[model samples]
Target: MVSGTSRAAGNLSAEVTNLVGRRGESAEVRRLLAASRLVTLTGPGGVGKTRLAIDVARRLQSSFHDGAWLTALAQLTEPDLLVPTLMSAIDNGAYESVRVEELTALIGDRQMLLVLDNCEHLLDACAALTAEVLRSCPYIRVLTTSLEPLQIDGESLYRVPPLSVTLSGRTFGAAVAGSDAVKLFMQRARAFNPDFSTTEDEERAIVDLCRRLDGLPLAIELAAAATRAMPVKVLAERARDALTLRSAGSRTAPSRHQTLRATMDYTYQLCSGKAGKLWACMSVFRSGVDIVGLEQVCVGDDLPLEDLWSTLAELVDKSIVNLNGSRYVMLEVIRRYGQERLTELGEEDVVRSKLRSYVEDIVDELHSGWFGPGQQAVLARVLTERASVRDVLSDYLRKSADLRSGLRVAANLWPLWISSGNPAEGRHWLDALLTASTEPTQERAAALWVDARLTLMEGDLTGALRLLDECESVASALGDLVSLARATTCRGGAYLYAGRVEDAMPFLKRGVKLERNLQDDNPHRAVGMGELAFALILRGDLEGAEQVLNEAKAFCARHGEQLLLSWVLVYQGLVALLDERVGDCVALVVDALDRKRAVDDPLGITYAIEILGWASFARGDARRAAALLSANEVRAERPGTHLMRDMPMVEWHASYVGQVRERLGARAFEAAWERGRRLTGADLFDYALAAKVPAVHDAPDLPLTPREREIAELVAVGKTNKEIASTLVIAHRTVDTHVENILTKLDFKSRTQIAALFGARARPET
Candidate 1:
């Protein structure tokens, strides 16, 4: 029944390249289409929205009796020919004489999916035709690929996100290989040179290229094509220039898509004057910018300050700019294109200078906000604009100008580097600024302390000690009490982490006394107190540790310091564990885990998981303990600097493993441990929290229809027929029929038996 004009049975084009990633998005799109008559895939141009829409329609070909029809609207120069073009695409013949009403009647009541591609240029025409078709044919569904929504009644819009290049902390190797962006690049690379292989460096270079391209499929493909003539490193280095090169795309693609610049030019030409000007000016921001920033830098000349928001709205509607919540971002390729336009208009220098000033102001605000109640919000903002800040620092330092500004910005971001698990990137910026500036100012002293903290996180105790010595010397020369306190605290933390507890205590106490004497509500005093307690605990001074922790906890609560509060909870949990109060330890550590998860602190979460695992082992839940340890191991192995290497983790790990092995025996413990390791972090948390394993039965020996199998699997998950119907976007009667057929095929009398059988079969054998 599925028939249309194409090599495939449907009107979908024969895909020359494989669709990579987007498995979740594809399923969600299918579900949306099943429930709504009109579903529009909307994103910026060249984001692969058209290809995704076609792929979704092709998958649902069997569901539509007549077929999925594709009408490409990109080539239509006038709105008058819209209906005629669609009719020809669907009918496989000339429909020059057919009127729009007659064409709507021709599609009447036929169950089908009509795909309207590239509808941004023909919005009015596409919307008019779509309204007519949907009103006349109730059973017909329309799927659209557009830069903007058709905005008709009952339309579902899904914004297509770019391919993921990073997961958790992984960015290269096997992890990078799994990303859809990298997969697309490799596939296209092999297409040109079949014998092509990559070394580790080349693979990393490709990953960097994909990331720089912002995972745009068209850009990735073009970059991949260049690999035929150039090495990956060379291609990555020249990517900004390569976007202007043409004729790399498939001949079958539209002329607009044959080159990156052409694709952008098409979109750019469609934008109105104000929108286009705004886009050009906004390009100066290398990362996302808020409305305030846009107003400050992107207003003047052709783009009046009063027209900013409205023009931005139009640009967003046209998909020329992406507005994510309060911040706006453009795809890297689009930004580059806009930058080129700005240069053409001779405003690049003005825009860039404005951008630099705005960023400098932001960094100053962040520095002032670092120790206040708004610290978390400031940190989040810095994380969002980290790339822009890095670029500005590099430019300032490279030119040997604004050295003090660069030094202050680097120094101010110490808490972020230490807590956000991005110490390596932070260290890179800090090193550049420190090496570029020779003056021993307060800014340099603070930057040196930040550098020492980051170095300590990387397990370089010797290097950290050296950095701290320099920091102390600079702080003494500058007579900066705050920098001196921070330096001394970091020194103590480094010694403690290196297992020199007695040596750590003196520095820790000295830092705490200095901070308290300054009469400041600084969080470093809290940090110093917590570290001193840990050193005391490791030295068997339990009473001293408890008193110090109590003081630290009260300080953290008064200051609204969640990160510091979480560490305090960890120390309390350790004290409870030392006291053999397993239940108390578990309760405290779980609360700590919640705090860490709220702040997205992975290192804190890892440490809490270690403590929870120990408490579980003490409570005789060996399997749960093993699972928690495995989860910690997985988290610790993420691509970043290590943060958990203290005495408690080391002692607890060895003891927990030894005790669990003795209790469960080597073979059974290994099996359980491996099972835990395979579970993702969220899955592991669920496993640890679940009361008991569900019962299961073996798989039935009868073959079943795909629909029946699908229904059976849903039934096994304990969903009723009505729930399954809603989830699958089908009629309740259809689910009942499928379930009936499933039971009949398996000779089961009850859904309970079906659930048990499917559950056992679906779960992997342990």
Candidate 2:
């Protein structure tokens, strides 16, 4: 199933909007992908390269073991960060930076398609990276879209043509309704303005507009957006005037690029002053932004906050901006035009500064909260604007702005950086800021501990200790108790991860003591107390551990926090297990696992499952313990095996596995573990949480008799009656009779239907 490779699976996301028209092009792309490892869909801007590539990949994703994944490079301005960005996108938000070697190895010989969108801005980097991947990964097919090709060896270039438009002596025809361009125009036009009637006259006007725009999808879309306010004929008649007004464009660029720019120019002219200004301001964002982000960054003296919504809606109506779910965005090319407008207005620096301030305020708010009920919502809100925020920070750091301010922003984003933002990127930002600003300020002290926490999460014990050392030194000198507490606890966490219980005990207690009495409702404070409890358990102090966890749980309950609350329960379960309260241990861990699942924390859920296994072993249910411990999760087959193996919680896991092995003979234990691997989805959850044995059932029999079934299989494989007769060593007449009976039994109209039913793509006539 991996095409030609050994392993991995594709992970293409579902499209938010329907693809208008690209039937012929999609088939051609599939054919190209079948033969070529690297296919570049090259065309002028606005020809729908990105959309077509994604559509074709979606159709073909299942054929590759590792499915097609798209990496949108429009936001990445730094070439050095390209590899990490690629890794993040392809890995679907893996929280670490992967080396080029590691990336290729992880994808080694796996069949997948990598769709690189908008490579025009970073052609050299895209080319180099593409070359390296194709060299190291023989089975991965690369489909890239750009204004031009990546220009590498063995590259197959598919010059994507504009959607077809029927022409009759430079005039409209009745057949024009069937044209791809006309269909696209009608669809976009009707979508924006439901009241706009699509009569035969309207179709004629749409056909004329499509033909005049040279059948370019983007130009057609822009023209169609104006149909709500005026007739399609009006927009069609005005098209030539708009196209010629902006006759100036890059000579090297294609004519379609000029046409698109001219359309943008006309779209801009149609806007009121306030609308135009806000549109330009909105360009400062690297990607989409929510309403709050738009108001904070775009609205000011020239554009009042109250009037911002109307102006944004105006642009959206004109098709210059698109409202995608909660965020407003301009297409990459549209964003570029807006950026030009921003620069022309001489407000680029001021606008970028506003974005930086907005990001700073957001991160500060996130830092102040994020351990309570609103935690997930706040994190998601900021993440929605991550691209814009990251661009602002990158712009600030590049301009050599206040290094300490940047460091503070990075420090405040610990939740994002460590838990969500791919801590590797956070480390990179912090490392850059830290190297630039060596002064032992309170900001730097805070950044040091946050970076240490990230390193601790990464299991980099020595690196964490080194950062914590600097953090302690700076905080001690500055007399910042909060920073000191963070650093001390983070250091203890590192030692605890390494199982250095005695080495961790003193620092854990001091850290908890320093943070426990803080008046503010900080989430980190409760988590710190919970860490001390974990250290106490590892140190053989059950009562002390229980007392600490009870306090941690109460603190979290007061804050309405479930994540840290779940951890408190896990710790309590450990204490109960050590106290020989087997029922309490199972109840506590199962309850914790339920909470962990609610928060979507894979590691936490795995920890709860492991603790539950310990309870099973204590009860002398060796068979139940083996079943509980089996790799039975359907890859969820062994629900937490991979994470469990690499986690620092391996301290007790190996010892327990040895105990279970000693109790059940190795062979019988292996059989139970294999059974565990067979469990998936709801069944796995049911058995894991309640010890309900999974039920087994057999599939229903097929309707066809043996010989008729054989004939049906042949038809599904695209064999004709002649081939079926030859293969089955039967008379041609008999094969035909069998085929007819098979069709009647399935109530099918065509052989293609049978092929589809069997999950085989019906091969087309040559």
Candidate 3:
């Protein structure tokens, strides 16, 4: 019997969905496949290059005896290793360094299809390999995907166009329903709102969406994801803010996503020295930036602040920047690339220094508004400049100096973090500040208080207690009542997590008294109260918890603290669940979930989803619960220390064991569970709750014999049936007989899936 690793490539077709507007492209692809050895699909980023290539490759897979091989190049940073990676895929994990001539000699007479996916970044490597393979392998075919053509000899280039949007006679929703763009939209939209199917009334807005996105596939996919909750009209309106969405941007995709950056670079290069300086300086803001910040931060008397508007307009026209009503923003990817180029041109450090000056000026402005009518605007500005704030903090930390500015910024961001349910991230930044301190300083103690509060949410009682103790001594030494109150509240919460209810009560009461005595009206103090309430809830102090939560809610409302309000709601939901008020629990949990999503708190969002999953399971909707758990699993896997905070979710993964086993096959499911358990050990709860997914176990030793597996491998690697027969010294008919048996055994209706199964695996992301 063949082990899984040594078996022939599975024979199956690459799945493709040809939407309404894809009819013309489908025919065009068929025509191109007739005699093309290398049919390269070129288009701009988001212009449907990948989708188009997949669609065509799927249709043509059966013609070639050897199935198609797909190699994705997106995450590959090192180009020199590209050819070797391709060879490994085709040669069944073998890394033999055969010359190009020798490699081609093995497949000289093979009628095979090679599909190179996402080749834009490694275009040069792709071109050279394609040329070598095609020249040497007589019957081998290659299909490549890129943002632009290789422009190599004998290469047939097919430029993929965006979805057609000429549905004037049809209403927008109707138009989209009949188009490939709308199908893709519906697929992603269903993820957000499964009930959201295409409706006639929503057609005009859908068409507008596709049109504004220039019918580009990637842009459409991203925009479609937004439609889960947004109204079609709102989606269309928001599209205007993204300049690349405009149809006039470019018809041709320039070999990947860099086309937009290239445009921005060209525009920046042509700017007046002052305009160029202004552009680089504007990179400081994290969120959508505005003219006022630019003027206040970037403009001087020589490039007077009043004259900034014209430069902004010029930049917008040239697509160097985007305008969103009063707010202007640059695409995150484009902005990063532009920053790199600007640095290479010797303008980065100078621009960054000026950007710092701008950030400081803005923070000063924020300070005035913190007590004024524009507090809302002030908070928005702070959130927008969060990245810049971090930069400032890093600068202060590096100099080993205690700057009131950095401290003040950290304190101010506390309310923002609490509102956004991003206390975890907030605590991380706070800890960074504390770590930078050379001594056991009072300021570090203040930061510890913040960190301690965050630890409570993740049920980390020990860490919270230790940090709270550290905060107490420091705050006492500094004689700061506010800091003392924060430390006191954190200690109380830690006690509550540790089940020391009697000890928790006194500390919480003291914290409340301190806040009232000191006239501390800060929303952070309210967050402390909320934390205390959550602690009370945990200890079964229902009436007291209710009263405290109400007070905290009112306090948050008064301060317009959305993040805090959401947490209060989450606590209320948890209380309702504990009290067996399932309906109330669902309502409150759903509300908090919505709020978390609105604030973009992945950590909070995952937590809410986890609770929702449990709630769904309680409601006997295991399927729905499994789906929620699965989504949370994806979010929890985000790289770096972010994975550490998700330990609770890691424990909950066992709850989905049955569901995972049912969906991924018993063997595969069991393997993953064993791996996870080995990694996490007994601290994680143990349970197997999955239904086993069905597979054809009978094929273990049936149909295709060892000889068939060998022939299938060569056929998949671009060897013709005749070449394979000759290599194995078998009759050509015997090779054909083996191929038929192999296909039957694998249950693959087409060779593309066979090729794809051999190619698809868990590759490490660069």
Number of backbone-clashing residue pairs for each candidate, in the order shown: 0, 13, 21
**Which rank order by TM-score, best down to worst?**
1, 2, 3
- The models' CA-based lDDT, in order, is 0.80, 0.73, 0.61
Query: What does the lDDT read for residue 534 in candidate 3?
Result: 68
Query: Model 3, 416: alpha-carbon shift in Å?
Result: 4.9
Candidate 3, 228: how far from true, in Å?
Answer: 46
Please tell me which model should have the higher lDDT, number 1 or number 2.
Answer: 1
Model 3 Cα lDDT, one tens digit per residue, 703-756:
556786577567556678899889999899988877777667666544432332
Identify the candidate with maximal TM-score.
1
RMSD (CA, angstroms), candidate 3: 24.2
The superposed Cα distance between candidate 1 and the true structure at residue 677, in angstroms, equals: 3.7
Query: Which residue runs does candidate 3 get wrong by more than 4 Å?
Result: 1-273, 283-288, 314-354, 357-386, 401-404, 415-428, 439-443, 455-463, 498-503, 577-582, 600-766
lDDT of 2 by residue, 537-557 (tens): 877888988888888888899
Give per-model TM-scores. 0.68, 0.57, 0.45
> In model 2, which regions exceed 4 Å deviation?
1-263, 616-648, 661-687, 690-766
Winner of 1 and 2 under TM-score:
1
List model 1 lDDT by residue over 309-387, tens digit each: 8899888887778877888988888989998999998987688777777777777777666665777788888788877
Output the worst ten-in-a-row residue range by lDDT, candidate 1: 690-699
TM-score of structure candidate 1: 0.68
